[model samples]
Target: MTSDRDWTGRVGDIWATEWRRTDRSFERLAPVLNAAIVAAAGPQAGTIVDIGCGAGATSLASAQALPDGQVIGIDLSPKLIAVANHRAGSLGNVAFRCADVASAVGMHAPVDLYVSRHGVMFFADPVAAFAQLDEAAAPGAALVFSCFAERAANRWAVETVAGADDASGPTGAMTAPGPLPLPIRPMSRRC
Candidate 1:
């Protein structure tokens, strides 16, 4: 599993340095996820939170789409947050912070929407983490996120990680906490 320690240190630094490549890796999915987020947020979303936002791409995109809304990107890595901040440049609507979203979400209470791009899987206790998010959300708030399918279904991920020497080796499948092998059931609930 990719622990918070790994993200806060080496993994985060590597991701920050390779953010361009990382973002490019998600080129196909970003548009779809962003569209879903925008659709779910609706026109009057006052505040949006991007959970585990790496370089703030989604946050920036959402901010651009909803000029009147506030977008905040939260991540566990200082390096990633720094990269996000740098990329934000003069975008006044979006901001990035380095912190654990599970614990810090309350500070941004009444969030109108929450979004993540392959980001929510890293939490040690996903239920608790999402509960925290639920606690912070405004009534009728929506959440949208994307995660890997299954290992057997993702040939690229399987092939890429086939040569791993151990479970902790370097590969998208190997490093991520809940990789392809874990089947994630779709969940929907209305509070």
Candidate 2:
């Protein structure tokens, strides 16, 4: 049986080995991530927690926005966290920790804002991890994260898949880029 610790360790090992290469791509997304966080949290986001903060670029950017506030960048990979800390040098309000957020409930201060850029998807238990993050935040705190809906919704991915498969990539179900009716409905009750 695969224990939780074992799984977490394995994940950390994989990222530790791949962080150098992955960091290059992740660096490019910092601007977009900043935009998303700014839009969601608005100006003056106090006490932010960045989940799955790979190399802490988004975390550093967020800390810059909140000069008086604090930001904690959390990740499972020790190597990535170390890099983040090294990069954080003279930044007093910014800090990085190697931890599994899903299991670190009540370990953080109540945050005014929470940001995750392409980071929330790696959770072993996404619902539980989100619940933990929610618990760690103050009431009325804003949660902001971006994720691509599906392969069909992403233009670059669609092009890549089409080219890879001789121009034949998932017919019929793929919705073209435009307004498409969704089956979603407003929730009448709060969970």
Q: Return the TM-score for candidate 1, rounded to 2 decimals.
A: 0.89
Q: Write the per-residue lDDT of candidate 2 for residues 19-135, one digit (tens) a residue.
A: 667667666676777887776566666777887786777888888876776888887777778778987899998988888866663577577777887666556555677787777
Residue pairs clashing in model 1 are: 151-180
List ranges where model 1 is wrong by over 4 Å.
Answer: 161-176
Q: What C-alpha RMSD separates each model from the true structure?
A: 3.5, 6.5
* TM-score (C-alpha, index-matched) for candidate 2: 0.70
The TM-score leader among the candidates is: 1
Error of 1 at 52 (Å): 0.4
Q: Residue 106 in model 1: shift from native, Å?
A: 0.1
Error of model 2, residue 101, in angstroms = 1.3
In model 1, the worst 10-residue window by lDDT is 167-176
